[model samples]
Target: MELRPWALLLSLLLLPSLALAAGKCERLVITGSPDAPPLLWRDPQDPTHLIGATADVLQQVAKDLGVKIDLLYGGTRSLALDEVRSGRMDILADAPLNLGELDNLDYIHPALVQTDYLVWTRKDSTLAYATAGDLQGLKGAVSERARLTPAFDTFATQHLNLQRLPTLTPVFQKLLLGEVDYVLAGRYSGMALAQTLGMSNDLIAHDTPIDQPGLYLAISHNSACNDPWLRGQLAKKMTELAGSGVAQAALQRNLERWKAQLQQPVGTQTK
Candidate 1:
């Protein structure tokens, strides 16, 4: 048998790709929002762990990829971002797409979810919210840590009179007290927290959403697990999950699960 020189060259060129595809990281440690439910939240009964759609979906991804995931509560959003950014945590699930993080993380594209940031007002308020301009004169509050589209960020900064509260609970509280005319947050997430705080009936989300931004899983470039093989596989799987409608279904299911859990008596909320 005669072998061509081009065949040898091609085989050598393909070797690195093959090796990369074969490389696997044994464990991936992840952290995310401690209180953002439907997508993720700290288990009320077990503060040490996180549970919800993001957790459940990642568990499935781990099974498919044959990797281990350690999803734990790493504290507040800033603290969780710090841990993953520093490489102490391997991944940040439900991470918002931001320019700052691009330097330190490899973002999985097409995102696991895209959230609708709604304009929430007291049910009795007369704020007519059809667009961003309608919010100009109104004093508003947004969750201090909320991440929004760059366009909205710019628009709000330039035109909207808004303050940042620690979280949605207080933002809504302020709205009800008239400290702010409106509060902005993800529609479903705001609803979950509203139900938990027993204020679901008191607030109304404007029919129009303020912004819809994609939320992703970001792997730290500083992590030992952030190799090309793992990143590629993770991205591939995420795209599949998104395309198959699995991610949306998980979100829908968890929305109901979160409401049910939040609605339960204190003694029965957890198992």
Candidate 2:
């Protein structure tokens, strides 16, 4: 039997739609902060360039998945979170999992790992604090909009005179200049920034961690790329990286290299 002309035309038109619906190129926009270095940070030599651990991991994932990534430089954590929530960004890399009641976003299972906050101060300063409570009456700085664990938040509220800053660099600078007695910062970030700013020895990171939480790759609910297959792929890749020790090895090597460079120092100029 011969097919009708109308039916043949319809089939041809629907063929494109079917193809379009299947295996289309997955494009994703990821937002990251320049302050969270060795995790995410702007390249010093080139202001437009972004580089770090999260960046590296995402790059690897993109390679493995055979997809392209568009990187957007987000200056603040709040701005980054907003971009992701608003669907302006497909993913927010290295973001602390804290979307209180916002179900529009879904996080991958078993976060990459936990990150903790450290109290950093200049070495010359004799001031010391055993815990967040010890800072009562002293001025302290924390990342703006940073979701401190309940315990830390309570301590900050009850004891310390907390000052919120948009980014970690300024907070560290303030601590160096005695603008703030101490700055609550991510231990890795604090160390990286200190080295980058030629203040590694100048800034002393305390042994105690104030707060720790799992970090995740947050996907926007409205993102077109959000789907189970994509999520599974990402989770699997993360698991492989973790189980194979690829992530930890990369982190340690990068940290040591960063520390070594800090010994020599570069990019002391701040933005």
Candidate 3:
């Protein structure tokens, strides 16, 4: 049969769609921060599973896109990232956008959510934290592994007196016990932890978040399915999710879930 001009034009119009369909990944393997509660974390009942905000958002996205995903507890944050970098995992459900990972990953932006670090202090402390600079003279405690914005990091390094602790619970203790003036920790996670420790009533968070870094869905470049189609699709869907308020809803739900889990009996407290 002879190819007509109309048929040729139709095929041309459909070329991009065809290419996208061809490159589409139907099933994705994903991992993220196993310790980042309310956003992503290892399930208590099953140490091998991961859940929370990121999982909730991805589940909705997967359903909308007609795709399947296996979100697993891949271990430490470093190990989970390594798995994605090596292509053993197709995606990182919760990742901060960084220039360093650009070579190995495509970040889906209009980020999935933000990881907010809040400044917490004892209710009776005289310290007034209206800005990062306000804590200049006060001794503050922070998680040693916490990631701070470059500007805040530099400011803190030069102007503030800081105590780097291995964990925030210790940091919070120091603040409560009048050892440190303030402690920096995640908003929701800190709330959950403080509640768990029976210290929520003794502390309060500053209105402004110390650092609010947006977390994104990142696709590994090493994956067999890594392509323009996958990246574009995810980014587009993420924008929709953000605008539709679905992402915020998921975050709120996860926060409540985290709070509930923390209220569990002592022996059954979740990881």
TM-score of 3: 0.86
For model 3, the run of ten residues with the poorest summed lDDT: 144-153
Count of clashes, each model: 0, 0, 0
Give the top-scoring candidate (TM-score). 3
Per-residue CA lDDT of model 3 for 1-271, tens digit only, reads: 9889999999999999888768568899999988877778888887788988889889878888788988898888889999999999999887877889999988888888766789998898878777887887788899875766767778788888998998767888888899988998888778767876889899998878988877888889988778786778888897787668777677788878988887679788644
| lDDT digits (tens) for residues 1-271 of candidate 2 | 8989999999999998777755654787888775565676666555565666777777888889988987677656677777788888788876666658258677876566566688888888777778666777888898774556766677677777999888767888888888998888877767777777778878888888878766788888978788788888888887777666666555666677566545654455334
Residue clash pairs of candidate 2: none
Cα TM-score per model: 0.85, 0.73, 0.86
Off by over 4 Å in 1: 1-23, 267-271
**Candidates 1 and 2 compared by TM-score, better number:** 1
TM-score of predicted structure 2: 0.73
Predicted model with the maximum lDDT: 1
- Judged by whole-model lDDT over C-alpha atoms, candidate 1 comes out at 0.87
After the best TM-score superposition of candidate 2, give how far the Cα of residue 56 lies from its true spot, in angstroms.
0.7
lDDT of 2 at 165: 88
Sort order, lDDT high to low: 1, 3, 2
